[model samples]
Target: MAGVRAGFSTDLGGRLNVEPEVRAVVDATATVFTDLGATVDDACIDLLDAAEVFFTQRAYDFAAWYGPSLHARPESFRDFVAWNIEVGLGLTVDDLLSKDAARVRLAVAVDDFFTDHDALVTATSQVLPFDASWDYPRSINGVPQEDYLDWMRAATLISSTGCPAVSVPAGFARPAGVPDAPELPVGIQIIGAPGRDVEVLRVAHAVEAATGHGRRHPDL
Candidate 1:
């Protein structure tokens, strides 16, 4: 990882929330079996812990194979990523009526996201790759991602203003005793604290390096 620093961002992926109720019991007694909610929580946690799987598309594709660490750091450090950004919600009188009201407002934002994505999709139709491959094109100038990001924002509506949203590499591991190998590039992400993208990137870099999977490639 020395002298190899890569900046990556994704719009398809976001930190997952396990429903407030499921989170309430993750720390329950060991004697208790994992209930439906607990199982759901575990799955959500696992999914978030596996963010690297989705960080696949980038603005730039490396010339040679990037080490596993270069891909993502698979580790579960926290619940979110730190974002040095601005996030907010503008509420109208309708949304103030009930929780479902928030959904209506959210839909508006989501529609906006779709619109943005569609615009980019249209513009990039000739250039965008429809499948995954090492020779596929890459772009990180922040142009192609507008739409993916729009959808992500609409799906994961932020409660607090731009705060910390982080992603940790979740190394691939299977059920205990299954001897499942680790997926070098797996990452779990968390998002928090806006205006601190540097911090988020720094921490993510360190975690990814420690996961020791960034330098390997599929030989495409």
Candidate 2:
């Protein structure tokens, strides 16, 4: 992601509406994990407390390594420095010790979660518009009209866990408010334990076979 940001930074940084969508997607996918952790096959779910920390730290490290060449939003970049550097560096000796303890617990939780469940299934994206025309030819500092970040929620969440996940076409549905909008594709995300990429892919194949959604094509 940082690499992609760097590539498009000069041309698209200020022009692209990227943060809101990404945040929305992450929040929506977090709910799926939280709910699944609570219920579903009596499985024990692992919730990482520092998931955002992992994400932001990676972003911050990328920024530090690459310098200001990659910028998402000015405000966002400031917050990254403030949270991961300024505030993080201010942590007391005791606080640092506690953080280490928390990470140990987090590791155990993650291990337990994978042990309990073979795979996880959820929406690929919470929201995406069929009308591509609305998103193209963006202007500088243009705010996204409506949030579509939920579209990558599953991917981001799974990424934090260092687990392998795949998204398969589930089916299609018409946009909720668009008049005469065509049906848009929906995806099902399948996630597996770390190093279980094969299992994830096999389940995704089974899902694709069962749904037969791949056979369909857009009206275009």
In order, what lDDT does every prediction score? 0.28, 0.48
TM-scores for the candidates: 0.28, 0.57
In the range 1-220, model 1's lDDT, one tens digit per residue, is: 1222111212222242221221222122111212211111121111221222222211112212222333354242221211101110233334234434434454454344333221100010112122354322233323343333322331233322223455443333222233543322333343323455675566556545554434553331
lDDT score, candidate 1, position 132: 59
TM-score of 1: 0.28
lDDT of 2 by residue, 1-220 (tens): 0111000011111222333332233234323333323223323234454445344444445546544433434464544344444434344556656555655665676577666567665545545443465432222124333322223334454555666878777556664455597666666566667788987776666556655667775665
Flag regions of model 1 displaced more than 4 Å.
1-92, 96-161, 164-166, 174-185, 217-220
